[model samples]
Target: MSNTSEAIDNDTVIKEFIDLFAQQDATTLAPYLDQDIVFENYGSPVVKGRENVVSLWAEVFSTMERVEFTTLNQAVNGDIVIAEQIHGLALPGRPFAPIKNMAVYRMRDGRIVEWRDYTNSEYARTLM
Candidate 1:
């Protein structure tokens, strides 16, 4: 659990954090991640540490021509926030596709300590 005394609005934090992905600027997004943050993408090996996670996102953002995340619903419990979202993505030459996704975020000291994303890998592969 995170420091409950911080009076953190975890829902807002998650919303803003996810919104940053649309900008595709990892540097701008880095501050929201804890130094020891852990990130796991669907069907992918877990990535540990903020730098590594940032690098991974940077690489992904490079390949993306456009990115948008629309949160269909959000639930917050203590230090965790769960979001159901449709991630619209467009590669350099490909058209945008709205991919259904569910993401779990763990917050500590106002930074995201852990994040796990669940998505339809088979459907996502069709866009790749």
Candidate 2:
């Protein structure tokens, strides 16, 4: 059992956090992450800490013209939520493209403590 004062709905929190990413609202996204969050995106180095993750997202948002994630499928098991998604991005001169990917999140007290993303590095590279 969790020692936290309130029980957290893992599914709801995961969905809301992803929705914030789809909206490119890093400011709103920050609160949903644990202070010592750990994130690993495919083809990228592992990022640790909530503030560092936010900074990374800030850099991404600044570089891209638009970005969004369309959830294709999702499942929740205990404190883990797995989501299959289509990542859409519109760069400065490129047309919007869809990148198939999946994200696994581990939640604690309604905040994400660990997040790991899986996707094709070749496809992701093309976006750059």
Per-prediction TM-score to the true structure, in the order listed: 0.91, 0.88
Instruction: Compose the digit string of candidate 2's lDDT tens values, residues 30-56.
Output: 999999999999788999999999999
Question: What's the lDDT for all of these models?
Answer: 0.88, 0.82
Which regions in candidate 2 have their CA more than 4 angstroms from the true location?
A: 1-8
How many clashes does each candidate structure show, in the order listed?
0, 0
The residue-level lDDT of candidate 2 at 67 comes to 88
Instruction: Itemize residue pairs with steric clashes in candidate 2.
Output: none
TM-score of 2: 0.88
